[model samples]
Target chain A: MSATDAEIYATRSFTETEVPMIELKGVSRRFAKKLDVAAKLARKLGADVKEEVVHAVDHVDLRVRKGEVVGLVGESGCGKSTLGRIVAGILPQSEGQVLWNGQDVATLPGEAARTAKLRRQMIFQDPYASLNPRMRVADIVGEAPQVHGLIKRGGFDEYVDEQMRRAGLDPAFKRRYPHQFSGGQRQRIGIARALAVQPEFIVCDEAVAALDVSIQAQILNLFMRLRRELDLTYLFISHDLGVVEHLSDRVVIMYLGRVVEEAPTERVFTAANHPYTRSLLDSVPRIGNRKRAFATVKGEIPSPLNPPSGCHFHPRCPLAFDRCKVEVPKLKAVDSLHRSACHLNDRA
Target chain B: MSAPTLEVRNLCTHFFTRAGVVKAVDDVSFTVDRGKVLGLVGESGSGKTVTGFSIMGLVDAPGRIVSGSILFQGKDLATLSEEEMRHLRGNRIAMIFQDPMMTLNPVLRIDTQMIETVLAHEKVSEDEARQRSRDALGMVGIPSPDERLKSYPHQFSGGMRQRVAIAIALLHRPELIVADEPTTALDVTIQGQILAEVQKLCATTGTAMIWITHDLSVVAGLADDIAVMYAGKVVEYGDVGEVLDKPLHPYTHGLIGSVPSRNKRGEPLRQIPGMTPSLLNLPEGCAFRARCPRAQADCVQRPELREWLPARLARCHHPHREEAAAA
Candidate 1:
């Protein structure tokens, strides 16, 4: 495809009734411990060594419509980042299919696959780590587009300047390296780089987690402004519920590789169905909840390598019972627009 | 109210670097009474952490407490010898770092570390130390403390490891604890659990705490009083509720306004323009002047921290008045 074709495809609008911008059908990703030669030799000698497999993303299904902001909320080991990677097409799912615009990405032709790859971009959590120290800001933001044939070589500097300006960075400082910029400025550089690719979907994996509160607000505003200007769909992954509630149109709560609740943002915050979701909402330290004693879930998050047999959250769940420990609850619709994976939902 | 547990007066801990003198914690002050929690809050380079380190007598060479009186129950900690401070370090006073791994010896078992902490300050048998270690673990809400005691620090999860660190800090029933962002690295749910334990411990044991952190929400729910630090100085100090609800200083106002929940959804947040100024070779007068929306010509003169309301102090020439805040 030519540059104009890519531009046309990037700017193509879709109604909410149409196919989702991205969809995950029964997606599951597993990470297994690889045995080295020594470990293999020990295993052959009848040592009590076993390969451990971690189900990072268990048969999860999701759909994000065009221009929708889907907030994926989870704790440290909940596999939200893995799921986001799969959705961004940077990582492949061990099972099931990742559909882009109603077409399975695995089976797409050469040019179509490349286009799909280019259409999705990611903004990482740590700005200091994600960016290369050696590269100047102009090259960092301009390289991908030039390499991908999105811009002509002569128009490179102009394109980089435009992207930087859109991301709220001074293009005059584009000659400086990443180390010279502040954390928030480096994040804007990352944003500028992602926008340089002209992506329709952006996966922000804790993009503002490293910055200060005031800087966080500045970056969050830039994101909203970019969304308004470019009509972008975002998969915002964060552990902070307040940020998720502020940006997301819909919220999906994950616990130990499984999504426990999915609902409209307002519904998830107000009338959450899953016990884990309720616990998470309660656990968030809010400015309004001043001098309030926090209500914590009972135990630590279980090891994903040896997750609970039935529900992953059952061990720490306060309302867990015999059924929760013995049955793997299915994600079912609890309301017209809300879905929850909990045994209590069956009874209700 | 009887001779507050820790009263930091006119603290100035500066780093004498070759580049220049970096005033990390200059003229900072706060008071934490017994059983009360004081939150020292700021962004990075705001000198909150330096203040905590100064109070603990942990400021190494090249960084010295230039001027200050850290009155701990009528004793000035700044004047103490290294050997004397060593005695008070973990016995009567304790410090909790941000990373649990910093406190926990990875090669040793949890029991060994806790027992060593107990034995360091007291003449107790190994069995008695072990018993105290087990009790401390149990007190921090670690389930099956006996089993957990035998496990290595790596065997425990992040939250559990932090609990072990906190339990070690509590071994001597330290009269004062200086916790520098202890829960900043944990998940929110885990942080909530840890904060709950700390709150309960402070309430029941009457152990004064100075919780230094960059998060306002965490401080709001945990601290009885708060000191807002900016450019190595206390910009505002007052009761937690008053400081959060009716912030007098523009820096505090901007900080509060920038929270995600405070703004209308999908709209632009009220952001304080420009990043935090560099500590080394800082501009004259207010360090926050460049970012303050209410900054004017008068802001060029450094404002002293003075009482604006009853029990409230702010360091700003043109503070946000009550009438102005109402309007």
Candidate 2:
């Protein structure tokens, strides 16, 4: 079955069953830098050189229900993008499993595997880099449907036309190349391409970060509209908290490759349970309120190669204590749904 | 009132590209009194940076200040020769760029760069210059200025690097400092700290400043006055509170409303439709008319920036005061 049909079927199934559309169980990925075998062997003999292993995504557990937009937020090297890639099945997890429709994506075979591929898609951060410069907008937008044979062989143009219309692009502009379109229009094409597959879940990795402030709003609204129209689920990853608060139904705040806090969007913004989340919230500049002093986190984000000892944020957390430095705090529920991995959750 | 320290009169800067002569800055005019911060705000390619560069006599070949005069302390800066302008550059006017590395050299130590900037403008002893550099670094909130001064640019974090760059700019204590989005790359806390230091410095030393940025929120907190730029023209100019609280131009209204902070949660963000017109092929009339909701037949004739009220200037034939009051 195609992604659109599967989405329709899932909506009907969801009316009776309560299974989440996607679930990630302790997914972690580590990448090793390229090195010669001789150099690797020499390093084992204490040759004053060490092989580097980047623990990009470390033991993240998350779940997204049907029609929910969950935001994954963190700084540049905090592994948010890596986790998004793992969830999209674009990169394999070194440890743990990904469940799509309660079936393990790693173990699925044939039609089930194909269905998993069609059910999820990703919208990359850079619209310019994501679209092919040499190809026409029609070919770029219709490639997914054409490759999957969802649309008939000769119906590529019509398929592209319909997707463009759905994405708020003029059909006549489909003949033009990606370079011919503006940044906002090009992002619309990227969204159209993702929607062409009719995926149940989409990972928007900093989707609007590259656009200007005004263009960013337009693109964000388009995403909101598409979510309502298609009943799609979104894993919105961004560094900007304002955008996250505007888009997310639930938010997962990450730091140094670990999920520090996860809560409903409104609660996370109003009464944050984690110090990092609080600091991130305070960092955003507001218009009317003048007296709110921003809490600038001291110390740079530690390199993932050598993260802080216990809680990764202990080095920079204002409320960090000796216990925070000695022992790792597992994510625990502070309330019914809000979860945070900080030792001082109850303390003022 | 004391004579305005920096008075700009009908400044126009144009770029001679292969396609045509692009009017990057058109008849822009504003004044900054001593010890005051005037913010120049606009989106990318809106020519805010070019205005700063033009005031510093930094506009190069194919791009020139076509008309108008830049009068700093009653002297015309546009008429100065290359040699005379070079002497005035770091001595009376200095600029802090968006990227700290643009002002700081990666190979040189922080102390070397800062000390040299001091010596470049004045005949000072090495020890005196070093002391001044240390003071400048300390002024910007870089902890342990002595130790930090010994390190290279790469040794510091991005925020710290920007601080070091800002410290270098402060070494000379110029009459005017043109900061072009210097803190846009910084985290809000660092940006706040820098903003505080910049404001304090301006107040203490009677230094006039032009802070160019795309973020209106930052300007709202820092600047005394603001000029909103669009398509290389000042769309609105007024006191910061007046301009922000009651923006008089359609472009200014769209910009202030479009920011994510201004809207409520869950609502679709308010956006000005259409992208900024390409400078290479600018429209003949009001540059914003193509995207403006209230465009009229009069908008086809380019409107000149005229004083709409006391110390308030707008380039719209029909400004937003009446609509704003009604709303």
Residues A1-348, model 2: lDDT tens digits? 133442343223123356678988898999887778888788889796666889998898988887777889988788999999988889899999899988898889989898898889999999889999999988898877888878986787888899999998999998899999888899999999999988989999999888888888888888888887898899999987778877777889999899999987778888898998887776666655442333456766788988889999998889899989988888988866678999896454
TM-score of every model versus the real structure: 0.96, 0.93
Q: Report the Cα lDDT for candidate 2.
A: 0.85
RMSD of each: 4.0, 4.0
Binned by DockQ into CAPRI classes (incorrect, acceptable, medium, high), candidate 2 is acceptable
Per-residue lDDT over B1-327 for candidate 2, one digit per residue giving the tens place of the 0 to 100 score: 978889999899998988889889988999999988898999888999999999999998799999999999998999999999999888788888999877788898988888888898889899999999999888888889999999998888777888887777777778888999988877554565566667677778888999999877778777888999998999999888888788889888888778776787667777899899999887778999999988998999999888777777899988886854554
Off by over 4 Å in 2: A1-17, A34-44, A290-295, A346-348, B188-193, B196-200, B203-206, B323-327
**Interface RMSD, in order shown:** 4.8, 4.6
Write candidate 1's Cα lDDT for A1-348 as tens digits.
223332333233334567998999999999999988898999999998888899999999998888788899999989999999999999999999999999999999999999999999999999999999999999999999999998886998899999999999999999999999999999999999999999999999999999999999999989988887898999999998989888887889999999989887778888999999998888888886688788887788888998998988888888888998888999997766778999987775
The TM-scores of chain A alone, one per candidate, are 0.94, 0.91
Q: What is the TM-score of chain B in candidate 2?
A: 0.96
Compared with the true structure, what per-residue lDDT tens digits does model 1 show for residues B222-295?
99999999989999999998888889999999998889976655667789999899898787888888888889
